[model samples]
Target chain A: MLAKRIIPCLDIKNGRTVKGINFENIRDAGDPIELASFYASQGADELVFLDIIATFENRKTLANLVKKVAHEINIPFIVGGGISSIEDVSILLNAGADKISINSYAVRNPIQIEKLAGFFGSQCIVVAIDTKYIDDDWFVYLNGGRIRLPLKAFDWAKQAESAGAGEILLTSMNHDGTKKGFAMDITMQLSKNLSIPVIASGGGGCMKDFLDVFEKAEADAALAASIFHYKEIEIPALKKYLNENNVETRL
Target chain B: MKVVIIKYNSGNVCSLANALERLGIRPILSDEPDELISADKVIFPGVGEAGNAMKYLKEKGLHLIIPELKQDVLGICLGMQLMCAHSEEGNTDCLNIFPLYVKKFVINKEDKYKIPHVGWNNIVLNNEVNSKLYLNTENNKYVYFVHSYYVEKGIFTSSETTYIIPFSASLKKDNFYAVQYHPEKSGKTGETILRNFINL
Candidate 1:
């Protein structure tokens, strides 16, 4: 059986790993490459480096940082943030990233997903959806989950899957960093509807949180920041816990 | 030495090249037959539909040269599937080097095990002494895999994995060796597997 994935997302700014509460008030965590290699050694299935700093200077540094991390780690690394064109995907992929993730740009111009998927197979392109709950329904958010859109979370995921996206990363702004648990309602609905793999992001605080998301939400993978970043939860330990919980993991 | 990666309208060339470079080996991307035949090792990788991949290989005339080569040859994911006797993806014919046929996973319907088994899974060695890919790893050590169809468990299977069905995860015959998993994406275990292949 295919093992469920445990992913640790790193928000990068000027070659350093940073974290924030709901995409604001960025605080430095550690060096980007060092933390990435550490996560790989700790048995993370994949790593996602989001270039939160979208400035030109930071973009160049993020590119260099991607090269540094790819040089050391042996797992799949996904690069996102400010990836506006195919050329950007090429540069990051050539620099050693196995896949390139797109968010704001992908929602604005949906054809970019098809174009990227056509050039580089759908497996190499990941479409991330940041969502916030509103009036009993979930709405898609762009620009780091600040601007909520009219399109619902499930609809966007269906559209993205139909557009040939290999995987969809769905993050809940309402539960992000709250340590309550995953957005099981949305994740369960999306996983049931979308044929493609769905990665549950945000609101994981412990091993039970991972188990809850996998069993209840039916997520293919779980992404976390604070729990992994602050050393509250380690990947190998979590995998071990999930294994004990009867979830198939690569342990 | 510049390694010429045979380009036959397939993905995974860049990742293979990157994996090689990690091992201090620089490879070249080439679809030209002469370039491929002259390289140190020929790596054929695919990530799309299986039958169409074989059609592209046959059209390029690389199919004939692939089996006759005395040099090392490796296939990754769909690349490995194309090396078998036949595939059920498009119900197309394959090279038949390993004498195996790829088949679709039959669903129980009552259960929800669907096609395209994606993500990391185990590698259980079928032949302990002859297995090169599973060397240095413990029995049932896991590796990354992504595919809808798999080579049915048979005499040619080197390593096997069990999900909805027990299937061949790696196959080996003389110099022709291939894995249904992506070593480039799998962590240390996959890196060591690729390293063993490059060294072999």
Candidate 2:
């Protein structure tokens, strides 16, 4: 059986980690490479680097940072935020990113997904869906959850899959940064409906939350940013907790 | 030792190069037949459609040269699939090095297995005498895999893993080694396997 993945997401701004990852060993938490290496040492299954403010010039810097992180870590690395075109994906993949996740651009131009999947096999294309529950239905949001679209979350997930997306990174806007728990109902729905792997992101507070998402939500992977960034939950200990709970996490 | 990674228009070559660099080996990425034949070890790494990749290989005449090389050759992911006799992906004909057919993974409605089995999965070694790929490694150690098509277990299968069914995780024959999983992305256990390959 494939082991459940524990991912540590780092928010990057201007080529540096934005959140101050409070780890005793890490002298500079703002350094992306330092935090990435720390996570790798702690047995993180994968890492996601989200460029919060991905300007044109900042994208170049993020590429360089990605190259550095790729050299420093051996695990799978995913880069997201402001990936708009094939050239952007090419630059990052050539710079050594294992996968590239797209959100707003994909929502606007769904055909780009199939084109990207054709150019760079579907294995590396991850479609990140930012959704918020509203009006008795889950709606997809764009531009970092500041704008809401008329598209339904579940419908968009299915469309992305058919558009050749290999995986879906589902983030619940309500649960994001709340540290409450993953969006179990929607995550479970997406995972069951899609044949591709679903990565449940947003709202991971405790180790039990990881287990709950995996066991109840049936998420193939659980992604958390602040909890891991702030050192609220250590990855190794969390994996240990999941393993003990029969979640089959990588230890 | 001179290590040469067969260069094709495939993905993940950079990552594989970085991985070799991590092991303190500067590998040459080349498709030149002479360079491949002269290298101490050759690695055929790929991540693309088999038909497209095969077209590129044939265009470079690598299709004719890869099978004839006498030195140790390692094929990864799509490289492994291409080393087989045939593949269901894109209906492409492979190098026939392993004399096996690569089939697409099909999950039944009742089964929960996902296609493109992308995650860390354990391998069950076939206990072959020449199988040094798992040297100093314990059983059930997880390795990273990302593929939609897989080669069925055969005489050359060195290790097996099951997603929906048992499939060749690693295949080995005279002077050729292939793994469906990405050792470069599998962390420590994967590094150990790559290190063992270098030592071999």
Candidate 3:
């Protein structure tokens, strides 16, 4: 049986790990490569490095950082943020990152997903969905959860699957830093509906929160930023906890 | 050493060359029998109809030279499937290096789960670890994958991945190594796996 995955997400800006609240008040966490290495050592199933600053200079920084991280790390690492085209995906993959995640751009140009999936294969493309609950419905948001799209979160997830998205990273903006736990209803519905692996992102407060999501959301993986970054929960320790709790985790 | 990447009108050879360049390994894109057998490593990569790809392989006499090569041989994506016994796609015949048949996903196309199992999937070590392929990797380590047709779990499968059904993600026999996933694009895991192949 496949063991569930626990992933730690690091936001990179100018080659450093940084995290912000609702995409603001960005504060430094540590070095991107160092932090990624640390997470892998701590038994994180995978690591995601999203270059928060996708500007020209920052993109260069990301590329350089990716080179350094790829040389040192051995686990799977996903790179995203400002990935607009297949060329961008190619550059990142060549830079030694494991998977290229596209959220905003993929939602806009769904055909590119199919093209990249055909050319590079589907496992290389991870479509990250930043969703928010508005008026009794979960809506998909882009631009780092600032702009809302017309389609609902569930619809976009299905669209992503149709577009050849390898995995779906469903993040709830509303519950994201609240620490209340993942929006299980939304993620569970998508997980139940889609055959592709669904990774639940955002809204991680404690180890219990992770258990709650895994038991309820039925996600293949869970991705958290602050909880893991701030040392609120240690990965190996959490894996042990999950294992003890009868969750199939690789400790 | 010059490597010959069999160019039988398959998928992007440019990416393969690009991955080689990243490793500072330059390979020639050639279908010539002489160049192919003489090369250090032969990579057969394709991404279309399996039957047509095998047809071209047979027409160019590559179908013969590929199996008897003493040098290391690597196959990626369709390249890997073509190295198998047969593929359900287009009802194609394969090289039969590994006596396994590729079959389509046994799931409803109408259901939410789609075909072409694409994306990152963990590689479950088949216990019979190949020293050449399964280096510095633990059991159930995730790798990238993208394919519709899969080789049913069998003896030749060195590594396996599960999607709609558990299938052989990689097969290893003697000097022949093949991966159903694109290691070129799998990021760090891809690079390490490729490097391991090169080192092997």
Which TM-score does chain B of candidate 2 obtain? 0.97
Badly placed stretches (over 4 Å) of model 3 are B1-36, B39-62, B74-79, B108-148, B153-174, B177-200
Listed in order, the DockQ scores are: 0.54, 0.83, 0.20
Query: What are the candidates' interface root-mean-square deviations?
Result: 2.3, 0.8, 5.9
lDDT tens readout by residue for model 3, A14-111: 77788887677889888777788788667777789888769866777787788777665656678899988777887887777767899888888889
Query: For residues B1-200, could you state the per-residue lDDT of candidate 1 as single tens digits?
Result: 55666788676565677677888988887778888888778787888777667888889898888888777778888888888988988888888888888888776646545345767888878864376766677777778776778888777688889878898888888887888888877787888888787777
DockQ of candidate 2 relative to the true structure: 0.83
Q: After superposition, how far is residue A202 of candidate 2 from its true place, in Å?
A: 0.6
Which CAPRI tier for candidate 2?
Answer: high
TM per candidate comes to 0.92, 0.97, 0.80
TM-score of chain A of each: 0.98, 0.95, 0.98
> Candidate 2 lDDT, tens digit per residue, B39-129?
9999999999999999999999999999999988999999999999999988999899989999998888877788889999998888863
Between prediction 1 and prediction 3, which has the larger DockQ? Answer: 1
lDDT values for all models: 0.83, 0.90, 0.80
- Candidate 1 per-residue lDDT, tens place, A103-168, comes to 988999998899998887788789999999998899999988768899999999999988888889
Q: Name the better of 1 and 3 by TM-score.
A: 1
State chain A's TM-score for model 1: 0.98
> Stretches of candidate 1 above 4 Å error?
A55-58, B1-4, B32-35, B38-40, B49-52, B88-91, B104-111
Lowest-lDDT window of 10 residues in candidate 3 chain B?
B111-120
lDDT of 2 at B51: 92
